[model samples]
Target: MNESLLGALRRAVGEPHVLTGDDCAPFLTDWRKVVTGRAAAVVRPGTTGQVRDVVRACLEHGTPIVPQGGNTGQVAGATPDQSGRAIVLQLGRMNRIRAIDAENDTLVAEAGCVLQAVQEAARAAGRLFPLSLGAEGTCLIGGNLATNAGGTQVLRYGNARELTLGLEVVTAEGEVWNGLRALRKDNTGYDLRDLYIGSEGTLGVITAATLKLFPLPAAQRTAFAATASIEQAVALLARARSMLGAELTGFELMSAVALELVPKHFPDQRLPLPAAPWFVLLETSDAEGESRASERFDALLSAALEAGEINDAAVAQTMAQSKAFWHLRESITLAVAAEGKCAKHDISIPTSRMAAFVTTTDRLLQERFAGVRSATFGHLGDGNLHYNILQPKGQDARSFAATQQDLSLLVHDRVRDHGGSISAEQGIGGLRTADLQRYEDPVKIALLRRIKQALDPRGLMNPGKVLPWQTMP
Candidate 1:
């Protein structure tokens, strides 16, 4: 640890808020428990101005800064490299609900506010902030905006980028760039906010945001069903949309292996299905209240049944029942973790090619790695699928992870073949940076590098993220 950097950080944001020694353990590891890195200190600033000053000092000292929100990101976007010269700019202390406009249906919140906290505040004010995700309890709004996060409600309310009206950011040069204008439409200049949203903090430190909100959904409905295959789930989703239209809010698909592991890990939240090839969880929301929502939902399920899309199904009879249905879908994370060793590939393809993609990947893994247990599931409506594979019984976890590169290539190449993306909701962090260079086109990669150079000339903002320093020949 550099004594000079520590002194600078202390002078900028007080000495007590700067974490050193063993106190920095919690901020060192990412949420997935995959990658762990070291940092000189964790700087917890209480306000946006303090963040600007801290960044400026780090820039002057030629030190790296890892801007962190809730540190709930699945990827190690917030984790620094082995070099302990970097500082973890912890935004958790800057939490505040800046303002809530009931009439405009917009919420101004600091970056450190928990996602669920933002939602609760909106609900209390008789409005809705629809950027819903499984990590709502811990994921911070800043990280969501930083990654342009897509959640279950993306099909209805769009991702965090769309829902966000403005931003307050600290640039790499330690300048406070305030772009917070809460307007519904602005055709003046480039959509600069988009550049920072999914850039994974490489571009800047997102301090706060003005997020758009929506009317409270008066009616809500949920359904869980068994599908013969991924094809059947896709068919049912289209059918539901034809009937429910924009009211369709969430549609998640689950695999038997993924669901099976859920009961194994979270015995309390098990689904009744013993063995099924595939499962689908669909939900709908409307502004008419929960009354008659079940009837409409049941009708949709019946229609899907007669259409031969669903082999078996269940509709929630009440709000409590609806919550339980979602609980089952959200349990996929725990389920995968319980399955021993697994590799996660966050990929997306055109909805039309999903069945073919799933079938091919499953067959390929079985042939290449004997005894490998694979589970394919996630938001089918949006075409983003979590095609994760559990390692074969005899293989060591480390050995299997070494083959992660080969596995990711096999999966991502197929996705690219099908006009899909290797990364969907998950942003490009340290682990994915190498693959981003490997798969991304030359022109696109070059443009990304230019953007990085333009904003972060010194490459000190969030080092070792987004794009790789080297590329394949």
Candidate 2:
């Protein structure tokens, strides 16, 4: 059966593209290196027609198909299971910018197009594709849409779902659904485009997307500020929103510990302000020139300082300085990985209760797990916190890693108590299926299961992800 399926895949996407043995190793592991699996073969398909043929071949043989793009997901959603009975459907070869309608402010890109390339294409067209992420250079648009990624700019432009108008998906049955309408107001039936999105490939494979674009900002201002506490950071966010309004594009909150890691690991990255308990990095885009942007930023920061919302602040005076400020923020993830084993939680809480939640969670963690350091930060404007807990200094790495489940459970329990979601920007990939079952409402879970059964009855679409294997028929 494995040989038959491999033969079909090879025929569909060429023999050279059907990788086996040592060549398949790269696609079997996840980005975080937390979980590794095995696959029968790794198939790279270059076109939607090839994707459809691969899906059909897998379906005919009753083989599981794990759709993968860029393999940059935090969770193990793109990895296959240990059975070695499935094929990793890699989509990196299908990268292409199909079309760009500047008048409609939309760009159609293949699923494998790198996000940074898409942004550059939009810039070349005198427009802006506002989905900015730390991994934009490597992460593909399909994965971003599959996970509904939320980046720093989400405060103003919203997540990937909002930025996307339509999708070209190859369903579980190998049928192409061309719902790639660029219309802003389409009152269609079921909204199938959204159904496939954020599904993590459980329902279908996102082959391409029609993404919305906006006019390039005349000027963008970047600022970094130090705050005494999370409360002050939240207050500062409120002030920015009130004064800057729509111009405020990004607002990120970082712990002093999180920032300290950047300079500790990278050594070249410098902090702009003195050490404090918390810091905020914000950006504002003005349709008007730099003069207007500078004026608004000055008013906002000055008011924040006067009200004691911030202890100190520094605004970037040049484009190089602005990129430097953002680089520091983006470097936090790599710094955390370099530190040691981490129990990471991507959670979202109401901005109103964010301060209390962080304070209480920190205290509870210290009380229960002695000396577990918190390296926390994330998009404060959109209420998504990358709240990560690092192993204590001088602790046994394996022992500390073992406590990941318990640590995450406690944090997620508190998240539920505070009316927050356990999984925020990162979808419930294979890593959090158990957590999803634990924290999610039963009714919602039942509905999700039903949708899965309805869309992919054979359960061949990325099995053991988002929904547990035991729950599937």
Model 2 is weakest, by summed lDDT over 10 consecutive residues, at 1-10
Candidate 1 lDDT by residue in tens digits, 139-211: 9999999888998887788888889999998898888888888898988788888889998889899999999
What lDDT does model 2 reach? 0.94
Total colliding residue pairs, candidate 2: 0
TM-score, candidate number 2: 0.99
Candidate 1 local Cα displacement, residue 250, angstroms:
0.6
Q: Give the number of colliding residue pairs in candidate 1.
A: 3
| Steric clash pairs (candidate 2) | none
Quote the positional error of residue 130 for candidate 1 in Å: 1.1
Give the distance in Å from residue 96's predicted Cα in candidate 2 to where it truly belongs: 0.3
In the range 380-406, model 2's lDDT, one tens digit per residue, is: 999999999999899999999788888
